[model samples]
Target: MEVLIRPDADDAARTVAGIVHQALAEGVRTLGLATGSAPVGVYRELARRHRHEGLGFAGVDAFLLDEYVGLPPAHPQSLAEVIRRELAEHVDLDPARLHLPSGTAPDLFAEARRFERCLTEAGPLGLQILGIGVNGHIGFNEPGSSLASRTRLKTLTDDTRRDNARFFGSIDDVPRHVITQGLATIGEASHLVLIATGPHKARAVAAAVEGPLTATCPASVLQLHPHATVVVDELAASRLEQQAYYRCIARHKPARHRY
Candidate 1:
């Protein structure tokens, strides 16, 4: 695991965008994408590069990490719509190349299995982008989720529901379930880059990066990944005991090494 600490969110975004750009330059085609405020800056930076620097996503295929189970595809708060509004529509990537699990399928469990099969057939993702939740959840694989679990429908915890309520206008409007890739599925990616910001995420970040590898903190699975990178602002890195060590390592890492 590699951790990079930046002064603020924008700097962290720039660092991550640089890594993504380098990955594309090296001919990486399959990407795992994430949504939410934490990654908005990274998307904005990438979009800027697309608009001004001619960086293109036309050749890339993207898979979303998860989706709210009961939300309509057209719903404003739906993960699909959020991705479109935030990243996909802003890039040159083909709309058909963006893959999303069907959260609204009549047979949701079957849909999840189908999605998992398709993902496996496609092989390992070149790069998987992630956003750590304040509660240490990743892609809705909440506390108590099995480390070897696969893609499936998962119940949302009250804490998670409350955290997401603002996006849905009210707590009551939040979906009770979601379809998410499990830790095992995420671990199959060739690379995992998690971006986090704000002091609110400090404790969870510490728990994920420095604490024991346990399902109680789903993000802790990153520690088990062969190639995992955690990019966070100083505020979010606050609780990390090895902050100085991480900073020094990042500073001394070879330029040839991305992230």
Candidate 2:
């Protein structure tokens, strides 16, 4: 695992965007993505790349990590709509290649199952983009989430609902249940890029990078990944007593200067 601490969020976002483009250039046609403030920078960077660098996703397929169960896919707060407005609509990626859990499906478990099968056919994902929850959750995999879990619907913790309440008008509007890929599902990706930012994530970030690979704090599972990169801003990495060690492993290569 490698950790890259940037001066701030935007710098970290640009760095993540470069990493996304690098993965794409390496012939990765399928991307597993996440929805959260942490990965918004990566999506923004991808938008810029498409607008200015001719970065194309013509052959790329995208699979979202999770979505609220009760929310309509058409809802603006829905992860599907967010991706459409934030990234997909602005890019050249084929709509047919965009895959998401069907919130409208009568049988959500079946929807999740079918989606998992799509993943098997489309993947193992070339790159899986992630966000570290303040509570050390990943893709709605909350505290006590099993390490070898599979795709399924899960109940969101009060803290997660409160954190996500900012996106909705109120906490009441946040769905308690969600369909998310299990820790095992995310772990199957060939490469993992976990993005986290802000002081809010300090303790969790510290636990993930420096702590043991345990299920108590789900993100700590990254410690077991062979090709995982944990990208954060300084504030998030603040609790890491061994900052220099992580820094030395993540020396940056400027996107502009790389070619």
* Each prediction's TM-score versus the true structure: 0.98, 0.96
How well does candidate 1 match the true structure in TM-score terms?
0.98
Model 2 alpha-carbon drift over 4 Å, by segment:
252-259
Residue-level lDDT tens digits of model 1 in 106-207: 999999998898789879999998999888999999999999999999999999999889887899999999999988999999999999999999999999
lDDT of each: 0.91, 0.88
Q: Write the per-residue lDDT of candidate 2 for residues 102-154, one digit (tens) a residue.
A: 76679989988888898888869999999988899999999999999888888
Task: State the displacement of the C-alpha of residue 145, model 1, in Å, after optimal TM-score superposition.
Answer: 0.4
Top lDDT hit? 1
Model 1 C-alpha lDDT versus the unseen true structure: 0.91
Off by over 4 Å in 1: none
CA lDDT, candidate 1, residue 44: 90
Score residue 207 of candidate 1 by CA lDDT: 99
